[model samples]
Target: MDSFTLNKAAGAVLMVLILTMGVGIVSDIIFEPTIPGEPGYEIVLATPEDSTSEVEPEPDVVPIGERLMAASASAGENVAKKCAACHSFDQGGGNKVGPALWNVMGRKPGGLDGFGYSSAMTAYGEEKPEWTYEGMDNFLAAPKQYISGTSMGFAGLRRPEERADMIAYLRELSENPMPLPGQ
Candidate 1:
């Protein structure tokens, strides 16, 4: 072949190789398995099912608010631990660093006796009669946002389901536990 024809052939081959490698690299990056909690990624793997014995499925247990205190499910209890630093759930367990949370789920904000609350909580108390589920949900989602200047230093629970579970757990501690299932 002439020099110019040979050079053109070599350049075409190089271009094809570069394009092929670029596509392969892109595919690898896009298709690689990702581990869970990794930024912008998720991990998924399937394990083979056991073939020896046919195990019976456990009965579905709904977590009622009253039963949450005694039930084995740990979601609500797990979330409740976050409040232990400043609040107490046990009956007659007076205010700690924060007000006693024993029955605060339904009681009015800043209404508990002997507990000195900030102006924010007292202000919320003025307009809000009692802490219902919706009220508690809003408060727990963003404590400071709900009542600015509140003494509660907690940043607040960001997860809706987690807040719900914690509220359900708190309700279980009341003298009259509110009814809730699958909390």
Candidate 2:
């Protein structure tokens, strides 16, 4: 209200602030925090060798032919669903993002005329004339790895059983499915 009263109020606030600052400084000095040279817990990363020791050796993989012997086409159809986005499985099915995979089992890689085939795939076809059971298994296991520069973006089926099933399904897509290996 009055200049004197206002001055007193402002002085009180400034005193409070100063007291707070002083207390903080005193408390900090009294309770000085000690920082460790190293972190509280050291994070030890596993070296390649160390990691290998921890990882169990991969189980013995059954041969693709053996897996195919007991392969189920119905189960294979489900696995093939992943391929549907890129390829058409039906007979006379037109090419989608990838070529129509009808009769692809025995057919040569990159054989479809209308659909553009990557040069790598065409070269692969030149090297391997037809898609044999073992060849298909390897290719399906890792398309890019098998062909190197194949345009097929599918990551590939990891399980041998799934690959075998898929190969079985592809085999059935043909009018005369290639006889199962060793049969």
* Regions of model 2 farther than 4 Å from truth: 1-59
Residue 104 error, candidate 1, Å: 1.3
Task: Per model, state how many residue pairs clash.
Answer: 0, 0
How do all models score by TM-score? 0.57, 0.67
Candidate 1 residues 1-183, lDDT tens each? 799999999999999999999999999999997667746745664333422111221145222233334443257788888888888878899789998888776688799999999987897798888887666766777787677668889998876567667776777778886555444
Write candidate 2's Cα lDDT for 110-158 as tens digits. 8887999999888878887898888888888878767776888998888
Residue 27 in model 1: lDDT? 97
TM-score of 1: 0.57
lDDT of 1: 0.72
Candidate 1: give the clashing pairs. none
Model 2 TM-score, all chains together: 0.67
Best by lDDT: 2
